[model samples]
Target: MNEALQLLKKYWNHDNFRGLQAEIIDSVVSQKDTFAQLPTGGGKSICYQIPALLQDGITLVISPLVSLIKDQVENLQKKEIKAIGLTGGISSDEVSNLLDNCLYGNYKLLYLSPERLQSDWILERLKNLPIHLIAVDEAHCISQWGNDFRPAYLKIANLKTHFPKVPILALTASATPRVKKDILEILKIENAVVFEKSFDRDNIAYMVFEVEDKLFRMVQILRKNPEPSIVYVRNRKSCIEISRQLQQSGISATYYHGGLSSNEKNKNMTLWTSEKVQVIVATNAFGMGIDKGNVKTVIHIQLPDSMESYYQEAGRCGRNGQKAFAVLLNSASDYIQAESQFLAVLPDKEFLTKVYKKLNSYFQIGYGEGIDESFTFNVNEFCAQYQFPTLKTFNAIQFLDRQGIVTLSHEFSQKIIVQFLISSKEVIRYMSLNPQQEETIVTILRNYPGIYEIPAHLNLVLISKKANSTQEAVLQILEQLQKKEIISYRANGNDSTIIFNEVREDERTINRVSKFLLIQNDLKTKQLESVLKYVSTKNECKSRLILNYFGEQKKENCGICSYCITLKSKATPAIAVSKQIISALEDTSLDSRSLEKITGQPSDQVIFALQELLEYKVIEILSNNQYRLRK
Candidate 1:
């Protein structure tokens, strides 16, 4: 413990370990398989990171997201610690070189994706290295029941087979009981030591408001809590729009999204982190690597896809042990919008089967063949030939990727992004003048939402299908429209690559995994419904509801949430409140609403106080239902 504490102070400059971090570290250091479930901001990384620093040999870390891996590697390198990350799109030569360095170099941490384990050579190379510990970040992804399940994560169990002597440490921000079981079982960790911290934040007040104008409500909230704040939105367009609106109302705000270049992201982040900007309006992508703790408020203009996301996002604030707020705003239309965004885009079993077969046909792969065969996938051409919807078809391909049927990799250097520079009416007039281009122009406007507000990646094949033309024709029309300054377009070479991990009996392959697919989609629906219920429910304490969802039943209601504050105010007999209400009516006859404001008590408490006076015959009700002291 002394040595671990010393290393932590040297590298991270922390005086001591927090919460279960030290216990989890001790377990891992003793070479015991450990599953640690801590909520966001719980210092889960320190549990394994400190052990990695104290261990004799290099530690192997498997994480899900490339961005997360990159950030961790850079942070380690900043501390002058030797660390390396093997992310996707790297040449085999580079991977071989990095592995060689890990074998000989004084590297303490080596981070890579779970998909890398698919290569037998990589596994063989890893077996030769002196791996001290195996840490799996976002361990919940290994579970089929988890919110962000990835089949690639299931392959992490293979590392246990290879490194028979080393310990495995799994960490996640949130996980239900079912997900926890799946992780331990899938990882094949026998006699696992599990450390779970309560998923409760007492300092933050959870609030939900139903309003017709979310923007106006947001403005009011910002004004009320004029401390550092974050407003979460769902799309890039909303990020820009909300920030601009906030600025117009004299609130210093900035916006961040994935579409922004690295420079823009850094600038905006710097503005907010430096306290120069009071608020940051952003999509979900804005939260990675954020360590600011003074954020007094977190307001979500759009609901997240699941409770896991909601809890993580809402947990971002109140880390400084100060009172903070997590606000969620909803309108009547958000329910419909949520369904369309989540359910409509989900690819069903039949659609998934069709996508798999078409993919096999497009790649010219025969049944019982094509394992380990990789090909550059031209998504536009395939979608055109099949006349499939771009959004759902892409989702189906991704589902296959997750199920290990194929590996779908993207090369961001090449993409067809477009945004219309002119209004639809002006474009309609232009299209009528040049009727040859009408179909292509109309198709782009319809398929791509937010094309007018933000640049969107377009599936050229889908556009061609809608226009009843060829990809070449569509590209030509796009170029012509760009030349006329009607739209902005950017494109490069191929977009994605697909490698078949299984033999190409497409329908049978999909059928084999259909049950998992069904369960996952159903879970998505249930998760969304849970969030919907949490917001709509007025009687239950919001904090207790969240804790229950995470499989922790709190004995007492959190006294600060929107529900508890009212419930607590009314739970006691408001004798003083009754006297106050009576005194307010003594000067003149007054209605319940006026007494409410005059007494400065909650509506329920004030009404109960008035009722007590009426029942005791100490007050009289006028014909207009106004309360008056007994005459």
Candidate 2:
């Protein structure tokens, strides 16, 4: 523990650990398998990283996302730690060299995605390396019951057979009781020490607003807060549109999604992180492994599919322990749309079989073939070719991936990169002929150390600033350089990827998992239904509800949430009438006159209650003007 503390101060420059970090670190350092459930910003990395530094060999970290791996590796490198991240984009030769370096070099940490474990060569290399500890980030993904279950995570269990002596450390931000059990069982950890930090974020005040104009409400919230904020939307189009709208309204904002190039993503992230941008409107892809501690607000423009996702995302705010807000702008239509978009298109067994066969045909794969083969997938084109509904087709693919029949990766965008093909003397001679390109080339060379050796991710914004030119002008100069054979440039491109994990026995493969697939669909439907319930329930404590969903029993209400605040607001006769109407309609439907007679209230009060209920979708008005509970 003393060595661990000294190492922490040396690398992270922190004097102490936060929450359960110290306990988890002590357990791992003592060579015991440990499981940690910490909230966002709970400093989970240090629990394993400090131990890795204290030990002699390297720490093998299995992460689920490439962005996360890249971020951690970059941070570690900035601290002068020898760390390497093995991603899918790297060539086989690069992987070999990286593995060799880990074996022979004094590397402290090596991060790799779970999918890479499928390679026999990689596994053989791992067997030869001196592994001190194994850390699994986002450990909940190993559970089939988890929200973001990846089939590849199941392969992580094989590590027990290979490195039986190495201690294991598993970590996640959100997990239910069942997920925790599954994580331990799937990882084959026996009698592991479990450290659970409180899931409650007392500094963040949760608020759900039922609104008609979501954008208007969002603008109002932003104006009131006037701090670093993140607005989470449903789709890429919405991310762009909402960001533009915010910018038009004189707010410094940017948009981010999986479709953006790596350079663009980094640029936008830098703008937000450096406080150059006041707000970031993004899809769900924006926030993982992001360490912005002073985010004052996190607004969800659309309800997420499950409580796990919503909790994890909203927890991103207030990491610095100051007061912050987690607001959900919702409408009745949002609920309907969420249900239709996620629940309605759940593919059945027959549909799954058809999609499977079509997918194999699309890839020109024969029966009992295509195992471990991956291809660039265009969902729109495949749906168009088959005359199928795009949403249903996507859902079918997702189901297949979840069932381990296939592995579907998110849309990957190649980095915008440039490499100089000419020598320094050639560049100088060309610059003398074309003075307009001189500034851009000079700026690139000054900013990048080895552009001539390999293609490097170039920042057009920075270059434009340094070269005293517009971004368009900088891009044009790079294009000219490419045309003149002075440089090689590659623009960003977007495409989803799919790997067939099994052979192409369409029905036989899918039929075996059809029942399990239906169970998964049912679970998803229930999860979404829970979200709807969270939004529609008017008087319950918001914090308690979310905590209870994660299996935390809390009797006290968080007095800061919107629900508690509204409860403290001056109550009127109409509010009491509305509650009465909701209670009355909970069990059976009743017309206005019947409700009025049962409650012994005036007709006017009954009318007001009915109107309020109808507006909030708490009760639906039937054809005969009778009222019933919605859903």
Candidate 3:
């Protein structure tokens, strides 16, 4: 324990562990199977990383997100700790070399995706390594009841059979009681020491505003706070739209989504994290492993699909234990749109079967064929060929992936490979003829070996730095070389991979997964309803509601939430008026005059309550100036 504490201070510059981190580390170091439910920003990585440093052998980390693996590996490397991340698109030679390094290179950690466990060769190689601990990040995904369940996680239980002497540490930020029990069962962790941290974040103040002009409200909130913040939207298009709007209002802001290249994402993230930009307007793709501790606000311009996602995202703020805010700006139309969108994407089983057949046909795979085969997928091209809606097509593909019929890798930017077509002699002659392009060509040749023999991945940023040029200049030179027939360049883009897990059988496969689909849909509906209830309930503490939903009971009301604040401000009459309006609208539609008369409240109070109901989507206005319960 003393050695672990010394390493913690040496590597992370922290004198002690936070919350249950020290205890979790002790459990792992004592060779106990442990289940840890830490809240977001609870330093879950430290719990395993410290033990990995103190132990005798390599620690295997099973992560679900590629970005997370990359982020952690980079951070560890910055501390001069030996670590590596393995994912798809690597050559077989590279995998062999990486595994060899794990065995002989004295590496402290090896991070890999869950999907990689399907490779028998990799599993055979792992069996030879001396693994001290096996850590599963995002362990909640192993449960079917979890919000982000992945079928591939089921394979993790077999690790015990391979590494019989290794202890396991399972960590997650958010898991319900059912999901917690499922994790224990699926991981086969008997006699495990479970460590659960409190879900309440007292430094964070939750607020939900029912606003007509969401954008306007967002701007107002930004102006009031004017600190480092994050604004989340629903889609990539809105990410750009809201960012531009904020920029136009004289705020330094940028947008980020999964569609952008790796360089672009890193640049935007750097700008925001370094305080060069005041805000980052992004989709939910941002903020997985980001470690910015001074983020003062996180505002959601749109409602998320589930409370689990919402809680995780909102918890990204207030990591420094300062007073931070998580605000939601919503309208009645937004609620309706969210519900309708959910329904629209959930295709029927028949439609799912049709999609399955079409997918196999698109890939030119015969029945009972294509098991373990991978294909490059172009979703737009596939949709165009089938004349299918893009969203529906994507949903069907995701559903199939969840059912283990296929494996769809997340969209990662492809590598840029360049190979010189001309020989070394020809390259020397061309460079002498074109003095301007000589430096870049020479730099590329020197930095990347085998450029003349085979295509090699190149980093444009590194090339430009070595050549004393800009990235644009490097690209221009590469294009010039391509035109002059001096090289072959493949620019980076979105090229995803899909692996077929079984033979193509449309109806049989669909029927087998139909019950799972129904269960998924029901779970989604219930999750959305829970979110709606959280936003609509006016009498309870917002923090209490979120904690209770996660099965935490006996929690006191957080005095700083929007509801508590309103209560303290003596707004009891308004609450009574809103409840009366909701109860009266349950029977039938009524005009404002009739509602006011029925509730026996003043006209001003009735109008206020009606507006609140409409904004919260508890009621809707009909064409005849009548209000009724929203369907």
- Tell me, by TM-score, which candidate is best: 3
For residue 113, what is the lDDT in candidate 1? 81
Per-prediction TM-score:
0.74, 0.79, 0.80
- On residues 229-326, what C-alpha lDDT tens digit does candidate 1 reach at each position? 99999877899999999999989999998666454678899999999989999888888778788989999988788999999999999989899999
**What are the lDDT scores of the predictions, listed in order?**
0.85, 0.85, 0.86
lDDT of 3 at 258: 80
Residue 194 local lDDT, model 3 = 94
The alpha-carbon lDDT assigned to residue 226 of candidate 2 equals 91
- What is the alpha-carbon lDDT for the whole of candidate 1? 0.85
Q: Candidate 3: global Cα-lDDT?
A: 0.86
Name the lDDT value of residue 224 in candidate 2: 90
**Residue-level lDDT tens digits of model 2 in 1-631:** 7878888888878898787888898899899999999987788889888888888999999987766888899999999999999966566788999999999999999999887887889999999989989999999889878876776788999998999889899999889999999999999995899899888888889998775557767887899999999999988889999999999888889989977766678789999999999999988887777878899999998999998889988988998999999999886679889988888888998898999999999999999998778887878889999999998898899777756677677765444699999899999999899887788889999999799998899876788899999776787888888888889998765357887877789779987878777777888988998899998888799999999888998889999998898667654488888887788888899887678778877544566577787888888978776889999
Residues 29-96, candidate 3, lDDT per residue (tens digit)? 99999999998888899999999999888999998776688889999999999998986555568989
Clashes per candidate (backbone, < 3 Å):
0, 0, 0
Per-candidate RMSD, Å:
11.1, 8.3, 7.2
